[model samples]
Target: MTIIRQRLNELRRRAFAGRTGEIELFRSMLGAGGVLFLHGPGGIGKSALLDVLADVAGTASADPIRIDGRDVPPVPGSLQARSGSGRTVLLLDTYELLAPIDDWVREEFLPALPADAVVVIAARRPPSSRWLADPAWRELVRVVALRNLAPHDGRAYLAG
Candidate 1:
């Protein structure tokens, strides 16, 4: 990697302020098995949370596979192939772009994962009805609503 890219990543990590509760919650989810669904409006920090959690997953010995919905074609096969055969910490970003195959993902793809695998889905939209309607999913899923950072946290981010 270029020196600039490395520096940028370092800065990003350093600039990640606040979210202590969210980070703690994320750490708690790492050791256990289940899904974490983070949703909110634009620029609410869902993606940033996922990025930080990916690093946390690495420290926990879970291989993190990050797939941006915007980068891949809107096909289940493409997503499936990149999702690490259900053995890794799957970070699915920009889920709005992958909304077309939401059912396939929830019904077919997620079920195939290992019990120990961790899947974190970040999106602006709330999970579909099926996710909440299904009793099984209700047990395995945790929905965290991301809100705007506090004034102090925002200021800290800027100051960093």
Candidate 2:
């Protein structure tokens, strides 16, 4: 168990590099009853950032439910049922694959969630214009464009 724990810690450290601010911002936004949409190009570390956010949610005693678009059915209702009542953090990865249900999620599923439930989406593209165009959603949503790690952080990650 100790060896497994150590290995997991090492893997976590290696998976995330120089994303403390992002993680903290996600946490703060969630605490304030907000949703986060993280987007970036391929291999830009969006998935890794989601992993870190999950860890942060766990530490905060919030239930983190991770939904990968590749594995889930391409339906909005399917995701709606996944979010049970509680202080839950919904982590949606590969969100671009679920483009068909994007409007449903933004308009129906998210609004139906409990006030404390937070949704975190990581995608390869920015959010649809509908989210930005709507004056109401614009206030509740936070969009972050992830970037590559710094040189020092990259070196530290590789050295580890």
lDDT against the true structure, per candidate, is 0.85, 0.85
* TM-scores of the candidates in the order shown: 0.92, 0.91
> Candidate 1, TM-score vs. the true structure?
0.92
- Cα-based RMSD of the predictions, in order? 1.8, 1.9
Question: What digit string (tens of lDDT, one per residue) describes model 2 on residues 6-41?
Answer: 788668767567867788888786777778999999
- Candidate no. 2 TM-score: 0.91
lDDT of 1 by residue, 25-77 (tens): 77887767788888999888877888788888888887799998889987889
Those runs of model 2 whose alpha carbons end farther than 4 Å from true positions after fitting are 2-6
User: How much is 149 displaced in model 1, in angstroms?
Assistant: 0.7
User: How many clashes show up per model?
Assistant: 0, 0
Q: Locate the minimum summed-lDDT window of 10 residues in model 2.
A: 8-17
